[model samples]
Target chain A: SQELEQSPQSLIVQEGKNLTINCTSSKTLYGLYWYKQKYGEGLIFLMMLQKGGEEKSHEKITAKLDEKKQQSSLHITASQPSHAGIYLCGARRNRDDKIIFGKGTRLHILP
Target chain B: SQTIHQWPATLVQPVGSPLSLECTVEGTSNPNLYWYRQAAGRGLQLLFYSVGIGQISSEVPQNLSASRPQDRQFILSSKKLLLSDSGFYLCACSPSGYNEKLFFGSGTQLSVL
Candidate 1:
């Protein structure tokens, strides 16, 4: 079975600081997705990456899929208190396969 | 412009009690529906998925079952709940296509005592 391992399970950063969260897969990924969730709320779609070496950005958040298609990184520039939440990375092995998610990185932005 | 609606933002049930959670998708028809459970420290686990009415695929063997009675309605049920079943339940939907992104519902926090 393929699994995604996220690094830095929890991170606390001061406002205006930059941070990066990583998601690595045990097998090749057909597609990778980034989502954000506020406490006790549903997940909001952030970005999706397909094709090796793909990168996408929305606002101050940027997501990148490595050339190998087995790793991805989400970076936040000039973090804000509003950015405090859980960031989840999900992936699928095939275009029609079920997407599985990582445990998620708990981010806390200090004001 | 698809949206998923899941009911019972929170729930508490005793062991052996029956459980039912409902999910409906609006703004779309014949979408793929899924049920995912997020246990503490256990990421999101795929419980069930359905591609069409009266069709369901179980991802794992558990104390739960899912039904798709209508094109846009998905339901998760259990004959008797267990303590280990306590977790955050999320309902999601995606268009029937390759490499489509999933839209999630607000989710239900289930606590089995």
Candidate 2:
């Protein structure tokens, strides 16, 4: 079975600082997804990366898939209180395979 | 316009009680459906998934079971609830074929006492 490990299980940063969360997979990744969840709420889709060396960004957040396809990172530029939440990384071994998620990185922003 | 609906926003039941959680998708046909559980301070665990009507796959053996009686409806059930079953239950859907971006529901917070 494939597994995903996220670094910095929990993080605390100043509201205007930048931070990056990393997700590493034990197996090659066919697809990688990033999602954000506020406490007690369902996950909100952020972005998806399929091809190696691919990078995508939305607003102040950016995600990139490594050339090896086994690692991905989510970076938040000038984080705000709204960026404080649990960020999870999900991956699939194949296009039709089931997706598995990481334990998630809890982000806390100090105003 | 794809949307996934899951209910009983919250549930509280005693041990040995029966349990059922329902999920439905609208504005899409033959979409892949899935049920996942998120334990406290843990990641989302895939419980069950279905590709089409009457087709179901279990990811881990537990006190729970799943059924897909309708094309867009998926149900998670348990004959007797267990304390370990308490978690945030989420239902998700994705378009058929290559697109695997999942749309999730508001989720059900199940507490088995």
Candidate 3:
């Protein structure tokens, strides 16, 4: 079973539209991180949240960690064509544990 | 100012052949290293990880194995290759066990014939 689960496996939106990708964990998540990967490329580090109910932002993307750190969501505001990629959420129970990954959300921006 | 490097961007191998993939990190010492495999259009699957030299942990059981000989060098190898091993192999490292911001290498696309 996957420890981390992402919703809406794939999505499409017109340029400048907003979208959100959700992730949930079956176990308590001590650290939740988001990464983006273009097709056939390696993952690019995005953001990480440790404390419960923590929220972080990077340009047009905002991510929030729930109070229990059992769930998280990444919100893309005014998405651009460059934002098109597979978004993955990874979580670990603690620093020394293996990071479990979600299936990822594939987003395509309509030009 | 740390960077991770992986070589042979692409490789084609036959069954029952030997395999070796190397990864090294610069500008950092005693960092945690990891290897992951990704199928086409899928998420990353952890293959192996190491917290220090001579300390490799396997996340998934397979014909492959990993070794960490140096402080910042990790190697993934197999004596007998399998066609099911074809996929994009990635190498990553984190500053320590605390931060989840693991830096990744460009990756190697391996095709088994």
Candidate 4:
């Protein structure tokens, strides 16, 4: 079984629309990270959430960790063409050095 | 600020050919280094990690091997490449701490024929 699960394997939205991506973990999350990967490129760090019930936002994107610390959600507002890319959620298990990633959500924006 | 450089950005080789991919970190000392491979439509798979010079921990058994010859350098090598080795290879580093955030390199796209 996969340790991490991401919903909506792929998403397509129109420009200026809003969308949300979700990540769920089977175990307790000690650290959660969100990254964006453009086509044929490395991942770009978006946000990191540690504590339960924590939420962080940068620009139009906001990531929140649930109170149970087992799930996270990333919401993007007024999506633009540049927001079209792959969004990946990674989680660290209790005290582990390695991060486990989900299969990623491929997001596309129509201009 | 720390940055990771991985090269060559893309590579192509025939089956049974030798392979070497290099990654180096700058502006950081004693950082934890890692190698990961992503197959098409799959998530990242941890291949190897190093805590310090001459130390390596393999997460899986495969045709590839990793070495840390210097504090900031990590190399991934294969005695004989296989067609299954074609994928996107990424190098990542984290500050020396448990559950730290990883910074990834630009990645190498490998095509084995």
Q: Which candidate is the best by DockQ?
A: 1
Ranking by DockQ: 1, 2, 4, 3
Expressed as tens digits, the lDDT of each residue in B1-113 for candidate 4 is: 78999999999999999999999999889999999998887787889999999999999889999999999999999999999999999999988776678899999999999
Q: Report the Cα lDDT for residue A102, model 4.
A: 88
Model 2 pairs in collision: none
**Across residues A9-89, which tens digit of lDDT does each residue of candidate 3 receive?**
999999999999999987778799999998878899899999899999999999999998899999999999999999999
The 10-residue segment of model 4 chain A with minimum total lDDT is A91-100
Backbone clash pairs for candidate 1 read none
Steric clash pairs (candidate 4): none
TM-score of chain B of each: 0.98, 0.97, 0.96, 0.97
- Which portions of model 4 show Cα errors greater than 4 Å? none
* C-alpha lDDT score of every prediction, in listed order: 0.95, 0.94, 0.90, 0.92
Worst 10 residues of 4 chain B by lDDT: B94-103
The TM-score between candidate 1 and the true structure equals 0.98
Q: What share of the true interface contacts does candidate 1 keep?
A: 0.90
Question: A1-111 in candidate 4: lDDT tens per residue?
Answer: 238899889999999999999999877888999999997788889999999999999999999999999999999999999999999999888766588788899999998
List the lowest-lDDT window of 10 residues for candidate 1 chain A. A91-100
